[model samples]
Target: MADSPGSGAAFPSQSPRTKKYSLTEEKIFYMNCRAAYLTVFKSSLENIISKDQLYLVLQHAGRNPSQKTINKYWTSQTAKLNFDDFCVILRKEKPTSKADLLKSFRQLDVNDDGSILHTDLYKFLTKRGEKMTREEVNAIINLPDVNADGKFDYIKFCKLYMTTNEQCLKTILGKLEVDSKLKCQQFGSHIEGTLERDPSPVPKPSPRVIRKTNQEMFSNKGGSRSPLLSSTRNFKTSVSLTITMSANSNQNPKLTEPNLIEDWQCVQSKGCFFLEEDGKIISHQYRMHIPEKSMVYLTIKPLKLSQVEGKPSPWLSVDTALYILVENESQANLQPLCFTELQNREVFGWTGELGPGIYWLIPSTTGCRLKKERKPVPEEALLVYRDETGKLFLTKEFRSALSDIFEVIDLDGNGLLSLEEYNFFELRASGEKCDEDAWAVCRENFDTKKNELTRQGFMELNMMEASDQGGDPRDLWVILHSMGYNKALELTEACPFVINIHAEKCKPRIKAVCMEACNGQLEKTICKYVLTNGSAKSMDGYENIIIYTYKHDSWITSVIENKLDNKLIIHVNNELSKNCVNNKGLNTYVVEVAPKSTMVCQHVMPLNERQEWIYHFLSSIKWT
Candidate 1:
């Protein structure tokens, strides 16, 4: 596979196990219902039923058992059970012949006991529990009550219990058989209801069902074997009886034929057309109905010439446009328009329906509203493009303005114009010749070997040259003023820089080197200075003056300079020396200052006060 654009390179495919199912609300609700029914069934069967047998019954009724539990049950020996074995347990041992029933009862009389009492009934029911109902219990007792005694002997109990157990098993198993004929008829009624709501113009019997029963059984299409259900004839079931009550009722059908033409009308009304399978009006077409407002895309094609003037006039043809009628109940009286045109010489239209009793003309000139062709907007050229060296490069429209003067100075087509080019323009306005030596210094220091000065380089060179002769660099500053350097630096630092200088108004550190001492201070009396790399360390010495200590970590540094009464106080953070380290070496320095030194240092550290408070609270307070 090709690498995706702008991604640089390709990586190996991810593991297949990464995908997972998202169990939405509807899915969880369905599973909860299935689980409830499964739990009830398992309880009824007790320990005799295997999980697999129960799963089969639930599966037939449309339920998904988790694979993990199914696998665990299948491999477990305690729970493994065959369907036949379960059937035998459900039926119990009962006599099919009356002769055998009498003989079996005789065998149960272990001690020639003549009568069965409460003990025998209790033992039988204690094992069976409520599986057999009260009515069943009465019937079993009455079965062998010989001589109308109203009580069963041991012999009577054995015969009657076996007979009752057989009847119960047969009833439950009979309920489980799947009726194929019923499935087909129900699926058929679903299809017919859709057709009745949205009848097609084409004359053909609508599909009443999906015929899943036939599909499941038949292996070959035209086999010699007769179909279990008749193929050519329609099958009817009790569903028609249910349908008769609501046959003409206003209840809408859940499924309907595809609105091939209905969609075409929506597009046509807005002055558009639709073609292809979406608007195909024909017999034996397959369609399904989705819930209203469900997301679905519809396409449209214009009507054609022959279709417009048909033998009988159809709503859509080659000349007709399509329109859509949307039901927008969310917003009051909202009408949305969608239209498309034909790239070909002529157009075609298909029949469409809007709603009950509303239809469209297949191909008519007056059927659609005509759309006028729009004209293109006019454009004008501005100036020819030029490089930084003032060389023409490309022409552009007048509306296209240069970002800065550096764009005009890039003469060699290099990204950055050379220093010579910058000086040439700087001096051009002044009506003075360019200084060759000064220009060389600016070029060597600022311009990259591409022999180009980037927008930034051009501005810096212009400003430096202008300032060297005591000239204002405002012209250069204006060209690069769009960029807010202070804002950019502030965002990266996460906070604003604060400059504090406490100097006397009379004698401030305002000289070139001394003005630099202002660092970042609020004194307007001192001037602003841009400190480049090497220029910073050159003026580091401050004789008899306290210099703020430098830090090398992410920290909030606060510097305060006091110049009151000829005294200076410096506070360097000496917390680490006082708390963490105490060894004295050459690496560590201790300075002693005289009273007139004009500077003082102090170290402050934090104390664990919470510990002291907790200790006091526990010792002084008493519990009531």
Candidate 2:
């Protein structure tokens, strides 16, 4: 016999005990090889084999076997070999499956403490070309470390590697499935074309109603039907239904076509165009319906060259300039509201408030410059409103009156009306009678505790009420009067002026003014300063001083100084002013002294028991 590779080595003569031990060792080797292959590859003993499976088995067995050797045995003419044959060729003598995993974990653990530290994990990953920041490494370590000790035990380390391998396999399989679907779709289309060319009529097969589970629907299946195929069938059906419904709908057929406008003809004259009673162009190209005077929504279709020339013409490009012409009834003149170049858009909409009257909507390609020439397009333009009137006729008057009233009562100068301010305005409107029901409604809608009423809110409320009453100005007036705006002008004129100052400057001034106004009974009265800035610090050391400059252009500063001086005439004297003075070359600080009020710092501070006295004194001062 030829000498084998291990045949030349010296060996002891066979004995009965040695023979039994050798048999036992062979059995143990076979068992370990099977376990390692099954655990690593996750395959059964009867499954077909490939070179990739052999590689994984060898890798799991901690053996660096040659790829050529694996291929020569696994890749045979049979195309698929069983697990037993794979083991026979690869040599069924291997270490335990978990030994390799344990070796890898030990390499990462480094300290031989049974647990891998975050630093060790980071170093291991870096060695494997995974560049990670310290934070990222820490985050990954914390994931498997349930105790959050920033280390991974043997079990966790194994689990992490297993999960990573599964995720990587799933990702690769997903890409392969996507590529297969694209190829299948292309093939399916080609097959359908060939079937369609057949002379004989073919019977259609009934669709199979397969109820797929979530896993099946989302899995990588090369043979099963893809979601894309089903979605495409559904999309085709929906398109067909849409076409059938659109054909029966009332919308102009031409509007359904891209970049096409409806062709309209003059009803009364050969050349002159006019809007129909239903607010549509003579060709039904443009349409709008005004339900109220305040606003209207207009829809315009793209105009064609033929529609503009009143004759046979080539189709115009979708990118054409379009202009809106508004004929104001009050002015008896046409004016351009807005204009834009049309693109491949579904519909051009115009929504805004317009004055009451018969307004004609003329679409022109020449922009607003066409309106100046008083020339009309050959195609009749649409009428936006015919004999329509705005319900809120006194919109300007109402807004102006309310704005003035709000300004008078907005003592904090925060641009919003507070509940207390609203209440005071109500008192003036109702001759000092409180309307609790109206107040409750206002509070519910405005949520005065959370937010104040803005100007936009007031205008929107007015418009809503006007719309509800069929655009009647009288109804709006009634609503305003009910809210205490009937005597707004009278109340505004009689209202005392309120000054706005930094709370830091005004706190002591308020105390001094109260003491002076109440005949030195400051301790008996409760004085509170409403701090608009919402600062948490007390203004004890801070002094309220007005700086005056000789520069005449300082009109704003001078005006404020004059008001502060007039208000503090009773509290500030020449001697006290001299003590707290900071006079520069041109600027002088006029300091006014007063006692500080002991109260909680808040946005809204109220003076109890002496509300009228404080209001009178504060409102007497003027704000620039």
Which number leads on TM-score?
2
**Every model's TM-score:** 0.15, 0.17
lDDT of 2 at 47: 45
Name the weakest run of 10 consecutive residues (lDDT summed) in model 2: 238-247
lDDT of each: 0.27, 0.32
Q: Kindly report which residue stretches of model 1 are placed more than 4 angstroms away from their true locations once superposed.
A: 1-76, 82-101, 107-178, 181-624
In model 2, what is the error at residue 24, expressed in angstroms?
99
Cα lDDT for residue 591, candidate 1: 27
Instruction: Check candidate 2 and list the clashing pairs.
Output: 264-283, 391-471
Off by over 4 Å in 2: 1-394, 432-440, 446-449, 461-496, 500-624
Cα-based lDDT at residue 475, candidate 1: 45
Provide the global lDDT of candidate 2 against the true structure. Answer: 0.32
The best candidate in terms of lDDT:
2
Residue 520 of model 2, lDDT score: 16
User: Residue by residue across 1-624, what tens digits does model 2's lDDT show?
Assistant: 111111111222222222212224433444444444444443332344567766766655445455545654553444655444444444422333455778767876667777877666778765655366678666657674432476778656566556655464455434434554422221100111110122222232112222223244335333222222222232111000000001112233222322211221101100001111111111101112222244332344332211213332111211122234454554345454543222223233343454443333333221100011111234421211113443234344456655554554453446676565555444433424336676567656642534566655555545566666665456444334333232321110021222111111111111000001111111111111112211222112323422211110000001112222233311110110110111110011112223232221001111111121110000011121
lDDT string for model 1 (1-624, tens) is 111111211111122222233554433432322232333343221232566664564443333344543443344444533322222221221124546555645554445665544445545554553354556556656664541453457455445545554454343334322433322221110110010111112221112332344443244333221111222223221010000011112133222224442332121111111110111111100111222222222323332212112233122222322222233443223232221122122232222222221111111122111111112214322233446875433222111222223433343334565555554444333424457676566567774556555665654554454445344334423222211111111101000011111111111111001101111121111111111100111112332232232221111111223233443211121211111111111111122223342221211111211111100000000011
